[model samples]
Target chain A: MRARIVDKNDILKIVDILRKDHEVIAPFQGRGRDSFFDVVTDANRDQVKMHLHNPYYPPKRYVLPHIEKLFDIDQAKMDVKAAYVEPKRAIFGIRSCDVHGIYHLDRFYLGRDYKDPYYERLRRGLFLVNVVCTDKELDIDNGCFCMCANTGPASTEHFDLQLMDLGDVYMAVAGSPKGEALFADPIFKRGDDSHVQRRRSILNEVRKHFKLAVNWYSAAVRYITTGQVPEELWAQVGNRCLECGACTYLCPACTCFTVADRKVDGKVVERVRLWDSCALSGFTRMAGGHNPRRAVHDRRNRRFFRKLAHYFVQRELSMACVGCGRCIDVCHGDIGMPSVVEIIRRGCAGKENDSTIIKR
Target chain B: MTQPSSNDKNIYLPKVAILDRVQDEIQEVKTFFWHFENPADQEEFKKFRPGQFAQVSIFSQGEFPASLPPSPTEKETFFTVRTVGSVTSGLHQLKAGDKFAVRGPYGNGFPMEQYYGRNLVFVAGGIGLIPLRSCIIYALANRDRYKKIQVFYGSRSPRELMYTQNLREWEKIEGFEFYTTVDRGDADWKGNVGVVGSLFKKPDVKVPVENTTAFVCGPPIMFRFVIKDLKDMGFHDRDIVSTLERYMKCGVGKCGHCCIGMAYVCTDGPVFTYEQIKKLGEDI
Candidate 1:
């Protein structure tokens, strides 16, 4: 009915207690800087960084995986057989923006005349354990725009259990029945809202430290509806674009993908879904080698419009971006989100200047 | 919030279809009439429209979306293929009683209802005749509803022309004016020997543009030339409808392969009027 605190000394008791009812998956260093979810064993608390923000990929991998087999269709005989797959687990240390990313995906896929059985099955078998932001180690001076998008480290619903960091203990509140059942174990003891409020104030202080801001509420939609925004603008931003799809790869909400057909034993056709980005030159190639968006400038424009414009036409909301800084962090060209916006804005402001000069 | 359903995963699923009949039309082209071994789906397949196509798959040969060749109005169902790829080639090897997989009657078909009071002009090139075959049959089946029916068929050569028997049969139908031509003619050829676009030059061709609908399906180059001819003849862009063919993976909107600019060919159209297409930037 209330909340509890898992203290520094009780970390083992808490993970062991939580693992009783749920398959506890916590973030651990996989290889080098790459992070992955692993079973939370007692000796691995140092490896389990629960206070960290969203990892390399969103927790979406637990739900909508990159490659999943849909039902197999017999080509010779036009007969369809339904395929089903499901896995159950609990995730620890998910950030709020990543949670919202899953939420956006839900609205796009679930509860309709047609349902995504794979995503639905994966969603059904998981619990979300979110950690509120208290550690401000990642420098926010570079204008990360998550705050402007109204998604942040602070909880905005969707988590089953939310952990708020205090000086010596982690305050936990169960947001769902599953969370409630897990917290009812003796490993957790009832705590007060004062700790939550204190943590909340800390998160508020952390939010303001960010330097990035995308002022437009519906940048995706606006960009799409404002079609034909001159080729020069794209060429300007296009020059800076490294043509690498790192932004798409690290995005919490980016879901564009490709389907690859693999032959097993030269008899079976295995369709594998791999992540695809419109930013790539080969994204829309036809059989005889005709690419509609031939130029990188055109692709640059398309990538932005697809997120901000195209999907906006149908979904009303811009599916273009989720204000995640993954694109910023991963861009080798230094022509990531902040620069893209600035070039477009400056071009729109009649700068008549060329974007060819790469800035240091 | 709930996780998004992986409904998209279902699109790759194929359906089994047993081949009932195969008709070799031209040198390269053949028509396969197939039905579901599952009897209930056979009934649903019977209800497919004239222009909508099916994503047909031949075992171990890959899958491609082929136009439904038979008129929905007709009791028989089939698909016409111009054996160009591995899937179609595999399909070519199959005999009656063999089976394959099929998904759809996908894409926006020709607006049959809108053509009710209007004169219907059907323009097709080479194998593009396959999709138009359904519409031609439908218009002929219900010939009394429309004022005029004119079909202009074109091909690269005399031997490449498809539906020779049906083309002759279509001539016998009252109120139907059927004209065809070949870019290159054989010694025995008695018909007009020129590009199919030349057939539109015939003065008998009617263009009551205000109350007329034209269906165009062909190679992209032919489409452009024929459209310019239609526009020159004062046919309004809205009155000119064409079926587009692009690389389509999922017949549903999600797969993203058939996107032409912002338009998804699988969902928004495989059939779009010129009025709709002019705004979409680039060739459909």
Candidate 2:
């Protein structure tokens, strides 16, 4: 809870300090309107943008990679060796929703009875630098619902360091001792209560910028938990789904995966796990061809039920949806969280009989 | 941050197990007897309860979940796998002295001690007898704790019956009632020539409906018909139990592949009562 101020131009100096001990990754503008997170080396250090659209792909992959090796097997000796990679890394300019996404992953992977050693290893080395969203033109979008999801426009906790824009100066707050150590650098100047007031007023103004603000999130959760949403509504939603699995892949909180073993040079075998989607038909199909969730509508029902249901939310102590809106942006069928919630809200209001809302 | 030491236990890592023997139970299905290379691992695995399962790794092929067919009280550990996929087919090709790896004793196994002094009925069709074999042997080992035990097993034909050696032994247990049937009987077949459910209505047979629990496992069609028969006989939904199968990668609860409704079949159950199974809202 210590605050400091740095000049707008010297913000990269914080990245420089972090890079001395860790490989700092930050957001950079790609093609028009696209942004991505990459390593901030000397060549790309100057290109690190302080403000841009949140990347389509989540930063959770940094902690839990898309494909991770679980074991290396020596075929002849029948020896099995566990594999892991733990590089000291810092992700700079992460959004608040993505920060909460990592917290959800922590609850599911480490807080459970059996801890996932692979996720535990990578997460131990991660440093989060959360950037509060202030710029309406670049940061806020129509798809964002972080205000309703209660994760943004500024996070209250769960970050190592948090940065806020204040015109000429960037006010930085340290949430951990590791982040407070960076305040000793010459680029940082001590700030008083007046700067904290500025941070509060700026956050209040930025919260109004989100266009898709609605408070039906809890109502949707209630309907899903109680199973009040009729089967017809799910069928209508499932009819529009293309099953491309982009929604689950781009989601920051989704953590399903499938494992496989492949031969290497005909001497060893490597067991690897790749990110999996429940939307795929093969995800639940057993070896003898019996699939429990064979219907497309049943698969569509699973994605939302896992997120908004009370049982899962209570089990993990956090809702799986962070309101990052990447699913809204990436979904080809227009059946993202907000759309699905709207469908449920309308369906519960007796509009389900109307063909306009439930077209069947 | 501290690096994990070599001695730290990794749940995903499998221990080496060497195949001691193999028995071809039926066509395309074989039971492999194996033990962990380390005595410590074998000692730990022996504590597994019936209805639990293990992940078997075939090195270059892949890993698959298999039911532990041997009871904790049995002399050996084995897996009865039918060649259904690439991983199982790779296991079928292995000979004696071949090396593989295994992890677990995972899932909530049947709570056998809770069913003490109650009559037990076991109904299985074809290879569905694999998981139930463990429970049957465990019950027979502690035979004084139960009142009565009845077993009814059926297959497509006389040639497709599993665990014939154990079936022959159980039929001669004097006080126990053992029945076998086949959908189609060959010339040498003479015991019964109907579905497994037909044994429930035979003139000489009487199935106890009071203070009795029925364990049913088989193909989905058989399960549906047998469940109706059990319900018609006034068996409560809570008294009918079965094990479910799903495509799984991690035998632990981390992977979401085996999740149904709000429960993970890996953790909450592979063994569930008919009442609990109905709440899962998914087809068997």
lDDT of 2 at B135: 93
Q: Candidate 2 chain A, which ten residues in sequence have the lowest lDDT sum? A: A351-360
The prediction achieving the highest lDDT against the true structure is 2
Docking class of 2: medium
For B147-249, candidate 2 gives per-residue lDDT tens digits of: 8999999999999989889988998997789999999999999989999999999999999999999999999899999999999999999999999888999
| Ten contiguous residues with the weakest lDDT in model 2 chain B | B1-10
List lDDT for all candidates, in order: 0.71, 0.90
**Model 2 C-alpha lDDT per residue in residues A41-158, reported as the tens digit of each score:** 9999999998899999899999889999998888988777788888999999999999999999999999987889889889898999999999999999779998888899888888
Question: In terms of TM-score, how similar is model 2 to the real structure?
Answer: 0.96
Error of 1 at A256 (Å): 3.3
Enumerate the candidates' DockQ scores in order.
0.32, 0.77
